[model samples]
Target: MTVADTPQAAAFRRQVLIPLKLRLFLMQKLPMAWLAGLRLRQLTPEQAVVTIRFKFLTQNPFRSIYFACLAMAAEFASGIQAMMHVQAGGPVSMLVVKLEGDFTKKAVGLIAFTCPDGPLIAQAVAESCATGEGRTVVCTSTGVDEAGDVVAIFRLTWSFRAKC
Candidate 1:
């Protein structure tokens, strides 16, 4: 069976990762996410979503959300998926080797970023475990504004290596 199908991993995600307070605790430790008021809106084996509110701290001089804050939220959306896979499968070291962001428009109000490639990531981690080698996956995070307009698209290349 695949690691993602394991019961223990599934339990951990539902009982631990799904709770807002737990997610908040994690975000609090991350200074940028905390400053941006990032929230974990949803997390599953198939997708992860994060939101950052447009506030004074996150706003730029142009009266829009800072690009960095948007990038932070987008990274979280993709990173959280990798975290889930690592948590479920086994010990693995993961990092964002590269990041590419496209700001299509001004980010205002509440901005939500979604990554819908969790399953693919899980498979890659499983392969890495089996081969005892590192794997890289390019995950896409799409950011949308409160009005449902596309604000930005972030592509993050995450590398995962199994622990020795």
Candidate 2:
């Protein structure tokens, strides 16, 4: 069975699909993301979409969403997928080891960041768990504006290690 079909992954998916549960998760575990108004728009076995809007809390003096906020959304897009995979299997620790971002346009209005690297992340997590060694994968998250224009691209390298 696919990682997403596992009971733990299914449970995590259900928890995230509920807006109130997701909000409470962010409020308790990630206050900055909660304050920045980050929202998870979609989550699937192979993809995740997160959004951030240009609001007072997320905006910068430049009249646009701050770069850090954009990065947070992008990271969440990939991180959520990794989280699902980690939950599907045995205990594993995940962390973002590196992050690189490229801004192609000003981020205004609602920006959606999508990551289509769930399978890749799943493999890494599974390998780490099986081998009891660390594994790393680079997941790319692309951000687009409301008009469908590319706003930013972020490559986040995540490391996973199985726990004893």
Candidate 3:
């Protein structure tokens, strides 16, 4: 079973996200798909908000945010939110079996993806911990760019399993 679905697990997960320096360094080292300026904001028990600036220097010269980059942003936010929902006792292996995206519009400015559909994640996480059975959690990925316009909508599906 996983540890992150319970109150104890959530609290423990919060403890592990405390290293700002490490977080920043890792952000910098990650592949180009992620905007180094990615910022995470906590909204609620089952919600997570991630913000990223569209930078020309790190992007293609076409003067538009790349589709793959946007997809990565959505995927990363979803994975982290899922991880935060489980395994507070220790780390777990996560995988993305299926993912679908709808490009609503081009990301114009700093973009934010909200995990408003967190119930699916929270419920699946709780169920996994209770039964020690692995399952998939589905979450929505909504992206809005700097102009306060919708840039993309995505459906992220992830399968969680204990790292043991």
Clashing pairs in 3: 4-86, 4-87, 109-146
List residue ranges in candidate 1 displaced over 4 A.
1-4, 15-20
Give candidate 1's TM-score.
0.90
TM-score of each: 0.90, 0.97, 0.77
Error of 2 at 133 (Å): 0.6
- Per-residue lDDT of model 3, residues 3-110, tens digit only: 225676466446535657426544666644334556665534566677667676436566767777777778767766676666443445668889899987767578
lDDT winner between 1 and 3, please give it: 1
- Candidate 2 lDDT score relative to the true structure: 0.94
Candidate 2 lDDT, 29-141, residue by residue in tens = 99999999889999988899999999999889999999999999999999999999999989999999999999999999999999999999999988998999999999999
Note the residue pairs that clash in candidate 1: none
Comparing 2 with 3 on TM-score, the higher-scoring candidate is 2
Candidate 1 lDDT over 27-117, as tens digits, reads 6677667666788888878888899988999989999998988989999998878877888777889999999999999998889999998
Could you give me the TM-score of model 3 versus the true structure? 0.77
Model 3 lowest lDDT segment of ten: 1-10
Q: Scored by CA lDDT, what does every candidate get?
A: 0.84, 0.94, 0.67
Q: Pick the candidate with the highest TM-score.
A: 2
Error of 3 at 128 (Å): 2.1
Q: List the residue pairs that clash in candidate 2.
A: none
